[model samples]
Target: MKSNINVVFFLFIWGFLLACTKAADPGSTVIIDPVVDVDYSDTSLRLQDVAPFPIGASVSFNHLSNDPKLAAILYANFNELVFNSELKHGALVKADGSFDFTTADAFVDLAKDMDIYGHVLAWHRHQGTSYLNTLVGNLEQQELLLDPGFEKSTTVGSPYWFVLNSGDPKGTATIAVTTQTDEVKSGTSALKVVNPTAYGTADWRVQVASNNFQTVPGQKYVIRYTAKSLSGSGIIMVSAQAMDGSGVTHYPGGDKTITGEWQTITLSFTPTKENYRIVFNMGKKADTYLVDDVSVYSEVAAPDYAAIYTRLDEALHTFIGTTVGRYKDRIRKWEVVNEMFTDAGEIRSNANSPAPIVDGQKEYGYFIWSEFLKRDYGYLAFRYAEEADPTAELYINDYGLEYSDKKIDSLIAYVNEIRKRGAKVDGIGTQMHIDIHLSQAKIDKMFQKLASTGLKVRVSELDIRITNSSTPMPPTEALLEKQKEQYQRVVASYMKFVPPAQRAGIAVWGVLDQYNWQYNGGSDYPNLFSTEYKKKPAYGGFLMGLSEK
Candidate 1:
């Protein structure tokens, strides 16, 4: 009878809240539900009581930063900080392999000196190999494949190509190209003839020397040709001239041979103060080659060593300065450089070198996505960060530490080497990205061994991917009970290490399964929250342990 009364009271309160009238009150209204007493309890319960710290929830910079209420809730609750950054560009080591540190230095100076932390170092994955390969291939090889029609294409800054009058090879192969200064154009729109197309003579070539064009260096250009061979192999060479404004007389030259298949060629070259021209030739007879599609940009410059450090500095500032920057603060130690030690630990893997594949491993090569961190950039990046923030800890994070005890032993040895070489080493971030079933015991033990290094241990970016389901799995009564038990077990285990402080805080990689890396969580259960952000059994279990409020 008491239970039935409680249910009736709940509905009454629900209806009152739902039926509140702004028509009469306008601003706010209150609702009330009657309390009822129940019989002596006989309910079963599981998990220890929650002891929520005085702190609130973690502040996420991306979304929650915009909400004042949520932000206040976090500030009042959790002391954790989080910050995002704008150092989108990574510092480039120069072509000569020297650090410039201009861009990076500026950003870092702002952070380290100013006591900011929102923009600590990040890997900046936007320029991954897939993106770079496309940029390089298109600019260097495919840009030159344009068809030159009778209507000449715009040459506000296109390389000058000699379009020979197909009628015959005369001293006047009309150079119908546009120049910026208009020095080449005559009264009726005829351009001056430098090295005009000749019948069959010396390997004749006409090129738009990469002269004084007001554009970024290393821009891509398309060298196109529409040619008809009358007699000789109609060869048209589009070579980027060496930039040294020597009256177009002393131009550095290389020749690109054109085929009879009406082809367009692309060249990715850096332009200098020297004159660049498009040279055309027929080797023996009179033929014509027309051209189009020329452009320039400033994206791919030689490594700006200075800029690398400047950006690093900026990232550090954003990471530590704002409320959003709190996430980085909690990360007392971070993965400075990514991957350092292979199973062998000798041949570095960053600059496109291969890693030694484990025996019977199907994947071979250094930097294999599934295996190694694949390079030393992770190390170098960490070093720069340590210099900027001398006190805060730093680390080299990687996966595949499960090869054997030998691998972890080698990493320790490797960190020692880096420290000897002036790197401020702190700890290792082992990504527990795989499903728990694959190697749960090994994963747990790996943490134990890594902690033995005397450096901090973090379950950085932890997420167990469940790929099979799009919606929440209906928890069987048994499964819900099991989930509660499992969460309690994990939490309790971590509490054991509280005495030593060797283990820092553990963070779920994302808030929910939907936001996690495995967008489609496979068969494995992931996260303490459901996809909708509603608390799940795991959440209640965790909060029960964390909150004593």
Candidate 2:
């Protein structure tokens, strides 16, 4: 766009009223305004200036900041910028959960003049894999608690965590599963125990114990849980009891005092028996107690599920909040989550590297945040972004939306679901990275589905590749023409289907073919510009699409 900016010259013509002499009002000379003409012709127009919605292009911050010519082209045309990899998790976040925002800070400075959209706050790949995996420490310890939180409990009773004895004393005693919001300390439900009788006469009045679990002698085990009572005060006793004939019992963390306020309890001890059960001696108290997130594991290894959850949750918060907050006033849009689903639209699976580590993460390693935090993590991440920058338009971007029905639908469904869960997902970004041969029908359907959602729709990454099967590199003219038409169709479809109120904008994937990332250092040519930074035929076609009615 900048290369030809000079061709869009203005024509200034001075018109003299020579005919005024014939009609004549003597010294009162008739004057005419200079004729100014601006050529809106294809050869001279700029995509960013011509498009109704903002036009964006992905570029390397290094090239954008260091290479003046490339930077000039971007500044001359694009209004919004997407960094190729600098803004991603692996690029900014360290293995130790620290951030290096120096480059991103400079990008924010550039955003002062233009716009910079947040690439991602959470994703499966390009992650702080080491830090995340480290948090989910090793598999050295196995959980030994059966239905610890009473999740197996039906309305009637729990199968694994069952009532051993009740109503043995003067007072009534029973155990039930509670799903009340206030009663649940961690997960969706908690175990509710009420003992109306103080078990001073016989502690067996009400005994709710977990099914006995096998234990190894000399193995250390820890149980962590939160307990609270309806009233302001109560006393409860927890014990680890041997199921053997000896009937010996041990209080790992000793007895506990339950209160109106929830209190966390951690019981750690080494087992000296073959099998034992965790007992809630609530018969000692006459008040109702709620317990949740009761996890019992033996020993700490490199990674633990509970530990991983805590660390990753914190990391997710830090990554979203700190990064978004730093540029709260600068950026207008952010991808709170990206590519969370597979091509088949299922939640992505957990995976580790096939390659060794470099920097912080391995090339093939994946830390599926969704796998660890679950779907609710989306809401949490969105909330963090919202809190950091209330004005930013938050989005969750994904690829294959145009080609895969499952991918597209599931993404839309997930977006809607999270929105209902209080995530302010202002938009959904479809990364349309395709080949010139992509079906127009799929494009139409994809756009139609996105527009119907009424959320801001963005062509987050637009690039039409010319595969080797279709054409050879130094791409044949015919394929280039298809590329041109493909570009036009994308922008035109976006405009035609998405209402003006919902148009977030369209962003070309990259500036030049060589750096297109499709076949980096290879034959891939998937951008609007040639390697020389010269605008190609697709640029004009894209402009035409933006000019569409």
Candidate 3:
């Protein structure tokens, strides 16, 4: 009877174990189709073999170092390698002014080993804020004007300067130097201009004259001063004028709207005369204006509009010299300036954009660099890249130009403009990230437009999305076939439109569908290969496209 009880207990334990196994087994409930792997080596044609230009891909340095599969795919398919993020400004320069090049060194070493061409030298975005701000701070502290902070005072007024009431003599505007500690914007004193009543004449003004110093003629000078209003709202017309024997001639300055908060106004001018005076026309309003920290000096001594631009241009050159100078022997192609324009066909402006805060201090962005450099920013970038790597083919790269006519036109115009400014741009890179459904005619037109510029054209970042906006449908056989045909047409169109000489190369943006950045919501197949390093049907399509006349 005891033996019988032991057998029953054993059976009960076996039943519980079976139940647990069944619950843990996910394949038992769902059907998973086996993936058929296709070795690209076994294929009739490879991407690197059939292409006239060097076939390239933008690769992640981390993945290139860590993932053997990714490295194998890149090595087999591509002859040229472009880093997606590793070589950008922010990656190279650290906050402490030292460069971290462990990843970059590894990448270059791999490129050297694999016989892959290293492309790209400089780009605009992802720059180190702390390093750049330090440069700006150093220039700002270099004082040029005498008693710029309004700390020194004389019997006449502020040291080395005096107040003048010009224009309508009948106007009831008064001026004085104030030592009010609380009201001053900087130092222990400020220049106060009070207009008690509104003047009938528009030219009624209060001016500040330099007593001993005089501006150099035909030299760039920066005039910077702090100003605020006693009332919450008023308008102050500010101008830097040459008060010579002839008369007062206004330099390049404008009106400033004042609120309760203290604001610094900086202006740049090339003086026509040796002696100049800064004029603060406040007779139009019946309000008190408090001004402090007035300064006037050559562009080299101060950070004005032109000086900021000069410094930025120098910085760009320095960055390129440091980076490209180090790797020019290995890298022969560069995307000098990347994505300078917005999708709306406008230059990216930082006039009102939010500034980046580093260590609790706000720093300038790339837009500020662009603003200071103006249209010459691109010119300087290309020039600097060439100076660093003279043999490298520099290309200006931008996205959305392929789809939009306005954007393409703007890009062409910009290229021409830069060329006119003596920048020797070698190629134009159109980031062809398009949907499969986009018109082939539009793509052909974009290629033609780029070709007309007489510069080498590169289809820089090529990737096609196979999904609609709403959902990412599974990659059915029919959809895969359709995607294959679309890839064939694109490759064929590129070959057909671009002359063989001007075709710099076509680079696949990414290697595998699973690793594609476009696959955000669900499973979307966009690349020529699968996650398991198997060539998809799109691979065949690319080969066929190359085979065409």
List the candidates ranked by TM-score, beginning with the highest.
2, 3, 1
Number of the predicted model whose lDDT against the real structure is largest: 2
Q: Compute the lDDT of residue 435 as modeled in candidate 1.
A: 40
Local distance difference test, each candidate: 0.41, 0.76, 0.71
Model 3 lDDT tens row, 206-269 = 5556544577688777778788898857667656666677575664556677888898888888
TM-score on alpha carbons, each prediction: 0.47, 0.62, 0.60
Residue 219 shift from truth in candidate 1, angstroms? 13
**Least well predicted 10-residue stretch by lDDT in candidate 3:** 31-40
Q: Which stretches of candidate 2 lie over 4 Å from their true place?
A: 1-41, 140-304, 351-365, 468-472
Give the local distance difference test score of model 1: 0.41
Ranking by lDDT: 2, 3, 1
lDDT of 2 by residue, 305-335 (tens): 6766777788888888888888777777898
